[model samples]
Target: MKLFLVTKVVPFIMQLFVRFIYISSKKVFHHPKIDSKEPFIVAFWHGELLMQPFNYKRIRPKGKVSAMISEHKDGEAITRTVEYLGIDSIRGSSTRGGAKALIGAIKELKAGYDIAITPDGPKGPRHSVADGIVAISQKTNARILIFNCRPTKYWQFNSWDKFIVPKPFGKLEFFIQEPLDISSLEQKEAKELIQDKMLLNAMK
Candidate 1:
């Protein structure tokens, strides 16, 4: 029963809720032009995750996108939710199935999919960068693109990442930072670079 609710009921409700909010909100994206043809490792904070599928579709609908989702129970729901929006999921995270996840992500990027990741996820030091994201870039030679979203009015959860839910008819602002090439950098340096860029571009 719990599995049915988590995998089926939750996603069904979430898709309706997300779509309603997105349709009612005023979305504003701030970014320079980017090539749709080039693949990127799209990184965003877990707290800012709810609206990303909509944001990604609005910004780069033509690009094939897939995300590395954790194997946590909640992750299953999220994977189903995003699939409704046409985004693919590669199951795993920093804690569980990390090796296989990284390998899958690298393969996806090489195969021309924009691999999305919430670097501080599956459990968090909330909003902090993890080494695995950098390692994926190092192994795949993929550039990392930071995507951040902030809403004018929202509910903030007491969760570790201070998760947010945008209220209806609110303004949703998105920022897409310049992509960074970390393919040759040391893991520590690359992690810091991505973290700094993410912090600098954070909308709120």
Candidate 2:
């Protein structure tokens, strides 16, 4: 019953929540490489995912955006949220059915849809980059576009990922860093760089 309610209702609630964010907070985008409409890997920490479902329409309004979501109950709920909001989701997680997810992401990218990733998700140490994003970028030869959001006042959950929810009405600022090519960097280095760009200050 709980799963059914969550899967059915949360999507609508989340849509309203996203709208509240849009109306309550200020938004800004800094995409330096707008000349190229090439598909890239979009990443952010899992905690900051609350209002991300609105980002595609806010940033690339007409471009295709698909996310790599975990294959779990929570993921299923989130998949519904994204789908309801008009973003596509491919379900799989690092610990479960990951290989299939990677292939799906690659195919999506190849077909011109940008792939969104929570590098340290499906369980996280918070703000760390997992191996999946790096591996997917290297395999598909797609650049990783890391982004971040800092809200003036918000709710921070005590979950493993330190999940955050910005207060209904607050100042929210988003930063989009320039795309970083993973095909050129070693796996470990690529992961570190992606983590640093997402966690540390990459762009203001």
Candidate 3:
């Protein structure tokens, strides 16, 4: 009974929180070369997950976009939020079921679904990229695009990732880095290169 109440009531409250975020985040997308319809992987830090979904919803790609979520309680909450926004979720992480998740992402990409991943997510060393994204990109020949969201006013959590919650009606800056092609590089090299690019772009 307790579990049932928590699941139903907690998500209802979270849905309100998500609505507040959607209304507050004013997104400015910086995609000069890539069109919204193009199939590519969007990599962002987990801290910005709250607002990233709003940005993706605005973009409205013709294909589905899948996000990786860990199989944890918090991840269950996140999966609910993602589903609310009409985006698909794949449950896994670097430590558990990581390989399976990567393969799933690859298949999603091959089926023409644009994928989004919070590289430093589910549990993080804070802004670090795992090899799964790189592997999926290389296997699927998808371009990886680094994205970050900067909010004008927000509260930062004390958590590992310092998760941000934007104040209602605050402006958000969405930065999209140039796409990195993984077609030529080997898996090891591609992973390092993508990680470096994400780190560098996330700074601004």
Query: In lDDT terms, which candidate is top?
Result: 1
* Model 3: ten consecutive residues of lowest lDDT: 54-63
lDDT by residue for model 2 (71-96), tens: 88768878888787778988887877
lDDT of 3 by residue, 33-75 (tens): 6665567898888887777776666556445789988877767
Better of 1 and 2 by TM-score: 1
Count backbone clashes in candidate 1.
Answer: 0
lDDT of 1 by residue, 59-146 (tens): 7967789899998777899999999888999999999989999999989988888999999997899878988898888877788888
Candidate 1 deviant stretches above 4 angstroms = none
For each predicted model, how many residue pairs clash, with residues at least 3 apart or on different chains?
0, 0, 0
TM-scores, all models, native as reference: 0.96, 0.92, 0.87
Q: Whole-model Cα lDDT per candidate?
A: 0.87, 0.79, 0.76
- Identify the runs in model 2 with alpha carbons over 4 angstroms from their true place: 1-3, 202-204
Rank the models by TM-score, top first: 1, 2, 3
